[model samples]
Target: MPRILIAILLSCALSWPGIAQAWGPLGHRLVARLAEPRLTPQARAEIDRLLAIEQASSLADIANWADDLRANDPDLGRRSARWHFINIGEHDCAYDVAHACPNGDCVVEAIRIQADILADRTRPDAERLQALKFVVHFVGDVHQPLHAGYARDRGGNTVQVNLHGKGTNLHSLWDSRLLASARLGEDAYEARLRLDPDPLPAGTDPYTPGAPAVWAEQSCRIALAPGVYPPRSRIDDDYLLQHRPTVERQVQLAGARLAELLNIVLATEVSR
Candidate 1:
């Protein structure tokens, strides 16, 4: 695709109604913006090349493309919706492919597949662009503790609750509510997270042996943490105050890990 045309298509796609609304637009952009400056020069240049194919300005612009795929393209969405999350039993801390991610149909697996595609230079630009979007989105998804929560509740989607007097579900609450409660724009959110004096360590590689699984497991533990899943359906100020730090930390970790992954994959010299 011509670079200018690709850019136009992305602009249209981003504005379409019902774009995959993960992490709310704010959260995904925050992750992308945070990762932006941390990218290695090689990775930055490669990313620029890929974005030029679609005419995107930055990682944040394409961060939610996979979600948009889910909303606007039913066939692709149906096939990829499961790619956004993994469901583990509340009792299970371990992420076993057979029990939790049968046939590799989960976020952890999706990250692996997308990273491989993005890393392979021989792949067509269109394919790599799609993979790049998936990597950007899934990194944010895995950071959300509920995305790796109990299968019985559909990762807390089915658990109805009232947060700040508004009816919502546990999954949605984690996905957007807490972050939204801060009332910060995407830029502010990214700035605040970047200012964290203590950031979580990035993984050696996002696709390293057991890395995605470990990320999922870490989120699972957070989901199972006390008060995360309240006994009652109503969550108020106290709840938000308690878990806010965890949310901030997760975002920081995700951004750092994403930069680490992109740095490794995009820095590799893929032969034409």
Candidate 2:
């Protein structure tokens, strides 16, 4: 009896670590940030519509349907809870952000996928809502710092580093660690973020595919920089201070553009 209990415990311990590492910090931060009221107007309307549907349906049903649909679309590629996973040798990390055939604006693709799934009025309300949530979650992911990072390094995956004595890759740490230490909930963080309201750069248009080029360029700045992993001692506070502007800016851009895209998606339907 004791041996059986020990074996079960060991199995769970091993599995738990793998599961924990999967989403990393960036994933969690994205999920957390989505709870804000900053979604694009279209996303806001869709979210309202989704909330109504969810109230009438089970989330589990929605999850299953999304999983099935994503599996059928090979072009959509991997459904990451965090970064946008691109095929490393096959796709150029820095191709023309617009008109980059097949894999260019993956962020746009994620939104469109959600839109198509939700457009199917016949889907169960529960399933439709789930699809909507996935859309919301995915758009947020594509905007993250390292999501659009380099391909040869798998977005810094090749650079190994230690996080407070724990062995993990640089990409993994950026995806999560850098943001987790912020210690601010959505409201507080968003409030602080709004302190210096800078409009999107002059001449920058969110609707154009050019939007992503802007974001990719931002990520590229930090892609190979030493900051991927700060010195072990600076891991907590200094890293946050150094990268806060970049981190905050990315989140801000993501929220604003998310609203912009959502507005575009729902305009035709909402107008009706």
Candidate 3:
């Protein structure tokens, strides 16, 4: 009715497209599953604390904490990375290096750093939490077939794909495509995610070799290796038909694995 109201409504409607782009239906499916059955009591509490924070902290918080650790005591945080995002396109090349071995060594380094952080009770809870979130998010990313995909293609960035009509990159497709498809509006989405899963598997240390990253990379290579070259093909209905099942499986596995890792780190807190 009111002009301002109309503008607001229009803006909201317009924003949905972007929202859909970032958190597609499949992504929602994964998150919905994530918020259930796996997180231990402690992990859930930490997740709640994170959710309660009024503002969302970007990945920068995780990276910078390590930087500060390195600055304060070089031996404390020896991890380093050159860039993030696709290696090409003038963006942070570090992001492009999918937690892969040899070239993208930081991913493994991150796991070790996290292990170290968890072992030291002296570390600030805030920093610990930030690092934990990085582990959670990065683990999820690594599971994405494209995340551990081609080096030359910048892990699918060089590939162009059409998503629901608009042109998008392969990396963005995996980032948000599934969540967007779920169509669980924010309120409903958050409401459903109120619950957390059990805990991490016992004696399952992700920092060790052949852990989360290795597993994720192995899976991604299987699913996305064929399409890792240039011209990053557009992902559409046909592609979805063939790969949707694998995508769902990976998303489910990622959520479960993430819960497991949280459980391990928060064992003492949960037990207490």
Candidate 4:
């Protein structure tokens, strides 16, 4: 990883984490790192080509650009705030485009639109590169569960809790704390995830290329599951143990699917 990205990731982890969006920088980069080895030759080449425009070298290089928009480009950040997640927990963890995503503004729709832009060879590489960035980031976002969580609590951002003596919300805990609890650096953490001997939970297999809507619904269901809120709203090791596995699995799933998505969009010959 580059020093710049490492600085950004650490900065994100240290700051008021998850104050902006799902999965934070670590999760997004992990997803991209996991996707690297799975890319097809064409996809890799094209990705490299697109990234070269900004002097980037890997998917991880661009993974958190979407989240950094708040500081780097406020107008774009405001325009894309909703692209990080969707509210569907109250709607039975279902995919109702009209209700869950009005005016095609949510993460699900964002992924679809960005993918279209990326797949269009007619589009400028600069534009395609931005699309690639969004697709990488939003795909990871949709898998964070809370990103597709209930609207009532603003995806659990309002559901306060005490984590290791610090005050935060469930979303922030899941986004940064649980992962930070591992106390490993990015390289070591990725190694831990990569070397895990246990099989991934059944549905998280990345080979399954489901639509963004399906992905969001799956995440919403997880967010609404029991124990996620916990008794007395306290976040301790038990909560982390119970939920960190889900976070890891989602990261793995996001990485694999992100690779597949790029493979298709950057295939040797794409149709429009």
- Computed on alpha carbons, the lDDT of every model, listed in order, comes to 0.80, 0.50, 0.49, 0.83
Off by over 4 Å in 3: 1-36, 45-105, 163-165, 178-210, 223-235, 270-272
Model 4: residues >4 Å from true position, as ranges?
1-18, 197-210, 269-272
Candidate 4: Cα lDDT at 71: 86
Supply candidate 3's per-residue lDDT for 224: 50
Q: Which candidate do you rate higher for lDDT, 1 or 3?
A: 1
lDDT of 1 by residue, 127-159 (tens): 998899999999999888888888776777778
Error of 4 at 243 (Å): 1.2
Report residue 151 deviation for candidate 2 (angstroms).
Answer: 2.8
Model with the higher TM-score, candidate 1 or 2: 1
Residue 164 lDDT in candidate 4 = 74
lDDT of predicted model 4: 0.83
Report each candidate's C-alpha RMSD, comma-separated, in the order given: 8.6, 7.5, 11.0, 7.5
Error of 3 at 231 (Å): 9.4
Q: Write the per-residue lDDT of candidate 4 for residues 1-272, one digit (tens) a residue.
A: 99999999977543432354677778889999988987888899888888989899999999999999988997888788888888989889988888888898899999999998998888888899999999999999999988898888778888899977888988888787777777878898888888875334423544323488888998898899998887786667888888888888888888878887887777785433
Flag the better candidate by lDDT, 1 or 2.
1
* Candidate 2: tens digits of C-alpha lDDT, residues 1-272: 69999999877543321112312434334433533354445655655666765463322223223223334652332333222432222243453534432543354454556656666666676666755656545445555555555555555565666656667666566656656667776457656766657445422545543454455545555554566545542254555578766666665666555555555544544442
Model 2 pairs whose backbones collide: 25-176, 26-175, 26-176, 40-259, 42-262, 42-263
Clashing pairs in 4: none
